[model samples]
Target: TVAVVLFTSDLRLHDHPPLRAALAAADEVVPLFVRDPGVHAAGFDAPNRAAFLADCLRDLDASLRRRGGRLVVRTGPVVREVDAVAVECGAAEVHMAAGVSGYAQRREERLREALGRRGVVLRVHDAVITAVAAGAVTPAGSDHYAVFTPYFRRWSRERLRGTCPAPRTVRVPDAVRGEPLPSRGELSGLSPGLPTGGETPGRERFARWARSRLAEYEEGHDDLAGDATSRLSPYLHFGALSPVELVQRARSRGGAGAEAFVRQLCWRDFHHQVLAARPEASRRDYRPRHDQWRTEDEAAEDIAAWREGRTGYPVVDAAMRQLLHEGWMHNRARLLAASFLAKTLYVDWRVGARHFLDLLVDGDLVNNQLNWQWAAGTGTDTRPNRVLNPVRQGRRYDPSGAYVRRWVPELKDLDDRTVHEPWRLPEDRRAALGYPAPLIDLADGLTRFQHARGRGVT
Candidate 1:
């Protein structure tokens, strides 16, 4: 008997339930990945992620070869390709991890229907992409938790399934056709500092980072200049790293830092659960503020300035520029930058969400969209009217201006106090710096935001 394992977001071999289940149920297993055109059609195959995914595929194939098997790559519509492969391989079962996005839900339904026509059983595994399954725990009278604190409490108490060991040997049927693997070099326009992908590098990074930094994450993750947060998001986003394994590893090294890190992981699952319950929330507001937001056309120049990292707010610009250079940004930076665009600028949150999706290596539909909503006062945020003041945020998180200076070199010569507000410099010095002045006065922007929300200034 033969089984087919369809690799989607959950790419790594360790702790993979679908692959293990398939391997156990069959004499031979086909580790298949379909490069779905639907993903491209949906605008997910952005250049940075495409490059990172290419590296992931190449590395996955190499890993499989070392284990006496090889990954089978296919292209076209996902269901059609998956079915065709199942038929060609004479597979009795097809297994995959459950996904949260609307596209994934539709794709899963289509795959089940398509495969069932040919007598192949489709099995979907949970807790593969997320540490906990999306629908695993819920409050009474609710399909999902709307708040993170209660959700985190319930989520932490739930027992995780133990990790699976990588198979010592994987038997694969010969004569399975596959496309040529993708090359990272062939991908262009990637961020100059994009991290390498694949399970090997991801594991290695975690090993070193966890030992040195996970212990300090609680106290230091927000220190912009320290760069203290684990840069593991891309790996997690790609499923090159296992969330379950990460949770377990962090828990074993228990402390405030690990607890903080685990809370972050719980937040990831929280978003997944919310997204699963309401897939439409990906594009629409989970809790609409009925905000009269500026459209892309109405805010064209401001949008351009924000995207180009020239908004004249040092912290906001630095964060945006970091995303351009590294395809990632610090968590604290993400909040303030998002707040600037969605609240301070009073532009539509979707506008900033779309831009981040276009560039961020870790741009996930579930987390990215919801987080934007939180910042824009349109989601499950309890304090919807609260705004992130970038100037105060920069002073607190990047005190001494090293982070701003690192990304916005135009302020390298400014004193600590003036770096964050270079418009405060003398007229000649400010002009000499060649940096734009504050795009809009903070007080004016705040007043505009509060008024737009139909509230008097708080």
Candidate 2:
């Protein structure tokens, strides 16, 4: 007997349900990854993510090889490639982790139909991509929880699946053929400071963080200057680290910080379930506010300035510059930067979401789109009218101004008190610093947003 394990968002061998099931049910298994052109057509194959994905594939292949097997790589349509491999290997079944996106759901449906025609069964595994599968828990009256607090209350109680060890040995059929694995060197336009990707690096980082930093997470997660949060998001986005193992490990540590980090993991699951229930939220508003957002023509200069980190809002510009240089931004930075664009600039959330997807190494459709909407007052944020003031946010989170100095070097010489509001400096001194003036007066932007949202201007 033979089975094929189709690798999608879930890339690692550890705690991988589909792979383990395949190895158990078949004498030999074909571990497969397909480079689907459909993803490119959907405009998701950005260079940073592409480069990161190359590293993931290479690492997966290397891991499999260490177990006396190799990942079979193919290109073109996903369903077609999987079918061809199944036919070649004469596999009795194909197994894959369940996916949340509309594209992933459609791909799964197509694969089932196509493989069924070939007299092979398709087994879709849940709790593989996510710690808790989408739709596992629901409100008494609804298919999904629209708000997070209620969902988290329920999600916290659900027992996560046990972790699976990497197989001591994996047997692959001799007849299966695969393309040469891709290399990150072949890709361009990647962020210069983008971290290397792979399950090995991810696990090592997690182990170190769990030992040393989990205790400080609650107190320091939003300390932009301290950078105290664990940078495991890119690994999570690629499924290089299992959500299940992370939750388990954090809970074992048993502290306020560990609980806080677990809550964040729950947030990831929360967004996934929301996206699963409402797939159109990817392109359309989950809860529409009839916003007359500024188009590119109206907002071109502001948007360009925001993208180039020249908005003259020191903290916001620092965040944008960090994103450009590192391909990742602190969580607090993301919130303020997103707010500056969606709320202060009164630009469309979609515009900012598109740019983030282009550059973020850890960009996932559900999180990126919904988080942007949440910031823009069009999604599930209970306080839809709330606007984050970048200067105030900077003063609170990046109090020391070290984060700004690191990213926006021109402002390094300024005092911590003056760093966030360089415009407050004397004319000659401000000019000497070479930072641009604030894009729009903070008061003016607030009034514009309030008026647009039908609130009386203060």
Give the distance in Å from residue 68's predicted Cα in candidate 1 to where it truly belongs: 0.7
RMSD of each: 1.4, 1.5
On residues 1-458, what C-alpha lDDT tens digit does candidate 2 reach at each position?
99999999988999999999999999999999999998999889888898888888999999999999999999999999999999999999999999999988999999999999999999999988789999999999998999999999999999988899989899999999999998889988889999989898999999999899999999999999898888999899999999999999999989999999999999899999999999999999888887888988899999999999999999999999999988899999999999999989999999999999999999889999999988988888999899998888999998999999999999999999899999989999999998999999989998988888885222
Worst 10 residues of 2 by lDDT: 449-458
Query: Across residues 175-270, which tens digit of lDDT does each residue of candidate 1 receive?
Result: 578899877888788999999999889999999999999999999999999998889998999899999999999999999999999999999999
Q: What's the TM for model 2? A: 0.99
The TM-scores of all predictions, comma-separated, are 0.99, 0.99
Instruction: For candidate 1, list the clashing residue pairs, or say none.
Output: none
Model 2 misplacement above 4 A: 455-458
Measured by lDDT, the strongest candidate is 2
